[model samples]
Target: MHELAIMESALDLALGQARQGGAGRVRVIRLRIGTLSGVVPEALQFAFEALAPGTLAEGAQLAIEQVPACFWCAACAREFTSADLIAQCPDCRELSGDLRTGRELELTSLEID
Candidate 1:
Protein backbone atom coordinates (compact mmCIF):
# COMPACT_ATOMS: atom_id res chain seq x y z
CA MET A 1 0.00 0.00 0.00
CA HIS A 2 1.01 3.58 -0.49
CA GLU A 3 0.67 4.02 3.23
CA LEU A 4 4.01 2.25 3.58
CA ALA A 5 5.75 5.01 1.70
CA ILE A 6 3.89 7.66 3.63
CA MET A 7 4.76 6.00 6.90
CA GLU A 8 8.39 5.79 5.82
CA SER A 9 8.44 9.50 5.21
CA ALA A 10 6.83 10.11 8.55
CA LEU A 11 9.42 7.90 10.21
CA ASP A 12 12.20 9.84 8.55
CA LEU A 13 10.78 13.09 9.76
CA ALA A 14 10.27 11.72 13.26
CA LEU A 15 13.80 10.38 13.40
CA GLY A 16 15.18 13.71 12.24
CA GLN A 17 13.15 15.53 14.83
CA ALA A 18 14.12 13.12 17.56
CA ARG A 19 17.78 13.57 16.71
CA GLN A 20 17.47 17.32 16.55
CA GLY A 21 15.85 17.36 19.97
CA GLY A 22 18.50 15.01 21.38
CA ALA A 23 15.94 12.41 22.32
CA GLY A 24 17.14 8.95 23.20
CA ARG A 25 14.06 7.34 21.73
CA VAL A 26 10.64 8.14 20.40
CA ARG A 27 7.64 7.54 22.63
CA VAL A 28 4.85 8.64 20.36
CA ILE A 29 4.15 9.91 16.89
CA ARG A 30 1.02 12.01 16.61
CA LEU A 31 -0.46 12.65 13.24
CA ARG A 32 -3.39 14.50 11.67
CA ILE A 33 -4.66 12.47 8.74
CA GLY A 34 -7.68 14.01 7.08
CA THR A 35 -10.37 11.91 5.45
CA LEU A 36 -9.57 13.29 2.02
CA SER A 37 -5.91 12.47 2.47
CA GLY A 38 -6.60 9.00 0.98
CA VAL A 39 -4.57 7.16 3.64
CA VAL A 40 -6.31 4.44 5.59
CA PRO A 41 -5.82 4.47 9.35
CA GLU A 42 -5.30 0.74 9.79
CA ALA A 43 -2.99 0.54 6.83
CA LEU A 44 -0.97 3.44 8.04
CA GLN A 45 -0.72 1.96 11.49
CA PHE A 46 0.42 -1.35 10.15
CA ALA A 47 2.94 0.38 7.97
CA PHE A 48 4.32 2.28 10.92
CA GLU A 49 4.72 -0.85 12.96
CA ALA A 50 6.41 -2.65 10.15
CA LEU A 51 8.81 0.18 9.44
CA ALA A 52 9.45 1.29 12.99
CA PRO A 53 11.85 -1.48 13.92
CA GLY A 54 15.65 -0.79 14.11
CA THR A 55 14.96 2.90 14.39
CA LEU A 56 14.24 5.52 17.00
CA ALA A 57 10.52 4.87 16.66
CA GLU A 58 10.75 1.28 17.75
CA GLY A 59 7.88 0.42 20.08
CA ALA A 60 6.62 3.96 19.78
CA GLN A 61 2.91 4.60 20.00
CA LEU A 62 1.33 6.02 16.88
CA ALA A 63 -1.53 8.42 17.45
CA ILE A 64 -3.50 9.06 14.32
CA GLU A 65 -5.99 11.87 14.48
CA GLN A 66 -8.49 11.32 11.73
CA VAL A 67 -9.61 14.66 10.46
CA PRO A 68 -13.00 14.98 8.77
CA ALA A 69 -13.71 16.14 5.28
CA CYS A 70 -14.84 19.68 5.88
CA PHE A 71 -16.74 22.04 3.64
CA TRP A 72 -17.33 25.76 3.73
CA CYS A 73 -20.43 27.55 2.57
CA ALA A 74 -19.84 31.03 1.26
CA ALA A 75 -23.52 31.88 1.13
CA CYS A 76 -23.97 31.34 4.81
CA ALA A 77 -20.33 31.83 5.69
CA ARG A 78 -20.31 28.63 7.67
CA GLU A 79 -18.16 25.55 7.83
CA PHE A 80 -19.29 21.94 8.22
CA THR A 81 -18.12 18.34 8.03
CA SER A 82 -19.22 15.79 5.46
CA ALA A 83 -19.01 12.04 4.94
CA ASP A 84 -19.81 12.09 1.24
CA LEU A 85 -17.98 13.69 -1.66
CA ILE A 86 -21.13 15.43 -2.82
CA ALA A 87 -21.99 17.57 0.15
CA GLN A 88 -24.05 20.72 0.58
CA CYS A 89 -24.06 23.35 3.22
CA PRO A 90 -26.00 22.38 6.32
CA ASP A 91 -27.17 25.89 6.96
CA CYS A 92 -28.13 27.06 3.47
CA ARG A 93 -28.21 23.77 1.49
CA GLU A 94 -25.95 25.43 -1.06
CA LEU A 95 -22.71 24.25 -2.59
CA SER A 96 -19.68 24.92 -0.46
CA GLY A 97 -16.42 26.64 -1.19
CA ASP A 98 -13.06 24.92 -1.43
CA LEU A 99 -12.50 22.23 1.13
CA ARG A 100 -10.62 23.91 3.93
CA THR A 101 -9.45 21.21 6.37
CA GLY A 102 -9.60 17.91 4.60
CA ARG A 103 -6.69 16.40 2.66
CA GLU A 104 -4.30 16.93 5.54
CA LEU A 105 -1.48 14.47 6.17
CA GLU A 106 0.75 16.03 8.76
CA LEU A 107 2.72 15.17 11.87
CA THR A 108 1.12 17.37 14.52
CA SER A 109 3.40 16.40 17.40
CA LEU A 110 5.80 13.84 18.79
CA GLU A 111 6.61 12.58 22.24
CA ILE A 112 10.24 11.67 22.69
CA ASP A 113 12.14 10.09 25.47
Candidate 2:
Protein backbone atom coordinates (compact mmCIF):
# COMPACT_ATOMS: atom_id res chain seq x y z
CA MET A 1 0.00 0.00 0.00
CA HIS A 2 1.02 3.65 -0.30
CA GLU A 3 1.16 3.81 3.48
CA LEU A 4 4.34 1.71 3.35
CA ALA A 5 6.07 4.29 1.20
CA ILE A 6 4.83 7.12 3.34
CA MET A 7 5.95 5.40 6.53
CA GLU A 8 9.36 4.74 5.01
CA SER A 9 9.73 8.38 4.11
CA ALA A 10 8.71 9.38 7.63
CA LEU A 11 11.31 7.04 9.10
CA ASP A 12 13.96 8.49 6.82
CA LEU A 13 13.15 11.99 7.97
CA ALA A 14 13.03 10.98 11.64
CA LEU A 15 16.37 9.23 11.39
CA GLY A 16 17.87 12.19 9.66
CA GLN A 17 16.68 14.51 12.38
CA ALA A 18 17.97 12.19 15.10
CA ARG A 19 21.40 12.05 13.47
CA GLN A 20 21.48 15.80 13.07
CA GLY A 21 20.73 16.21 16.75
CA GLY A 22 23.31 13.60 17.77
CA ALA A 23 20.60 11.35 19.16
CA GLY A 24 21.72 7.78 19.69
CA ARG A 25 18.20 6.50 19.17
CA VAL A 26 14.76 7.74 18.43
CA ARG A 27 12.34 7.53 21.33
CA VAL A 28 9.19 8.58 19.62
CA ILE A 29 7.75 10.05 16.43
CA ARG A 30 4.58 12.12 16.50
CA LEU A 31 2.43 12.52 13.43
CA ARG A 32 -0.53 14.71 12.61
CA ILE A 33 -2.85 13.08 10.04
CA GLY A 34 -5.96 14.82 8.86
CA THR A 35 -9.13 12.88 8.12
CA LEU A 36 -9.04 13.96 4.48
CA SER A 37 -5.37 13.09 4.04
CA GLY A 38 -6.42 9.59 2.85
CA VAL A 39 -3.90 7.92 5.11
CA VAL A 40 -4.79 4.83 7.12
CA PRO A 41 -3.25 4.94 10.58
CA GLU A 42 -3.36 1.17 11.08
CA ALA A 43 -1.61 0.54 7.78
CA LEU A 44 1.03 3.12 8.59
CA GLN A 45 1.65 1.54 11.97
CA PHE A 46 2.02 -1.89 10.42
CA ALA A 47 4.38 -0.53 7.80
CA PHE A 48 6.53 1.15 10.41
CA GLU A 49 6.80 -2.08 12.38
CA ALA A 50 7.79 -3.98 9.26
CA LEU A 51 10.31 -1.47 7.90
CA ALA A 52 12.04 -0.04 10.96
CA PRO A 53 14.55 -2.85 11.51
CA GLY A 54 18.10 -1.73 12.30
CA THR A 55 17.16 1.93 11.85
CA LEU A 56 17.52 4.67 14.42
CA ALA A 57 13.77 4.42 15.00
CA GLU A 58 13.70 0.66 15.42
CA GLY A 59 12.13 0.84 18.81
CA ALA A 60 10.54 4.21 18.46
CA GLN A 61 7.01 4.83 19.59
CA LEU A 62 4.68 6.25 16.99
CA ALA A 63 1.96 8.66 18.10
CA ILE A 64 -0.71 9.44 15.57
CA GLU A 65 -2.84 12.54 16.05
CA GLN A 66 -6.04 12.56 14.07
CA VAL A 67 -7.23 15.87 12.66
CA PRO A 68 -10.78 16.46 11.56
CA ALA A 69 -11.69 18.02 8.24
CA CYS A 70 -12.78 21.64 8.66
CA PHE A 71 -14.36 23.90 6.11
CA TRP A 72 -15.46 27.50 5.88
CA CYS A 73 -19.09 27.79 4.92
CA ALA A 74 -19.86 31.03 3.18
CA ALA A 75 -23.60 30.55 3.37
CA CYS A 76 -23.50 29.77 7.05
CA ALA A 77 -20.80 32.33 7.67
CA ARG A 78 -18.91 29.94 9.92
CA GLU A 79 -16.46 27.10 10.00
CA PHE A 80 -17.43 23.52 10.69
CA THR A 81 -16.08 20.00 10.50
CA SER A 82 -16.92 18.06 7.38
CA ALA A 83 -18.44 14.64 7.86
CA ASP A 84 -17.95 13.50 4.26
CA LEU A 85 -16.58 14.48 0.86
CA ILE A 86 -19.83 16.06 -0.26
CA ALA A 87 -19.60 18.24 2.80
CA GLN A 88 -22.51 20.58 2.65
CA CYS A 89 -22.74 23.15 5.38
CA PRO A 90 -24.93 21.80 8.14
CA ASP A 91 -26.48 25.12 9.01
CA CYS A 92 -27.27 26.54 5.56
CA ARG A 93 -27.02 23.46 3.30
CA GLU A 94 -24.40 25.14 1.13
CA LEU A 95 -22.94 22.97 -1.64
CA SER A 96 -19.76 24.90 -2.22
CA GLY A 97 -17.30 25.99 0.44
CA ASP A 98 -13.62 26.54 1.15
CA LEU A 99 -11.63 23.99 3.06
CA ARG A 100 -9.88 25.49 6.07
CA THR A 101 -8.10 22.45 7.47
CA GLY A 102 -7.73 18.77 6.63
CA ARG A 103 -5.65 16.74 4.12
CA GLU A 104 -2.63 17.16 6.33
CA LEU A 105 0.00 14.44 6.66
CA GLU A 106 2.87 15.91 8.62
CA LEU A 107 5.52 14.86 11.09
CA THR A 108 4.91 17.29 13.89
CA SER A 109 7.53 16.26 16.39
CA LEU A 110 10.23 13.74 17.28
CA GLU A 111 11.42 12.75 20.72
CA ILE A 112 14.91 11.34 20.66
CA ASP A 113 17.72 10.52 23.00
TM-scores of the candidates in the order shown:
0.94, 0.94
The CA lDDT at 6 in model 1 is: 98
TM-score of model number 1: 0.94
Which residue runs does candidate 2 get wrong by more than 4 Å? none
Largest lDDT belongs to which candidate?
A: 1
How does model 2 fare in lDDT? 0.88
Q: How far is candidate 1 from the true structure (C-alpha RMSD, Å)?
A: 1.1
Which residue pairs overlap in candidate 1's backbone? none
Q: What's the distance in Å from true for residue 75, model 2?
A: 2.3
Q: Write candidate 1's Cα lDDT for 1-113 as tens digits.
A: 79999999999999999999999999999999999888999999999989999998999999999999988888877789997666798878887656888789999899999
lDDT (10s digit) by residue, model 2, range 10-33? 888888899999998999999999
Worst 10 residues of 1 by lDDT: 89-98
Clashes of 2: 0
Look at candidate 1 and tell me the lDDT of residue 83. 74
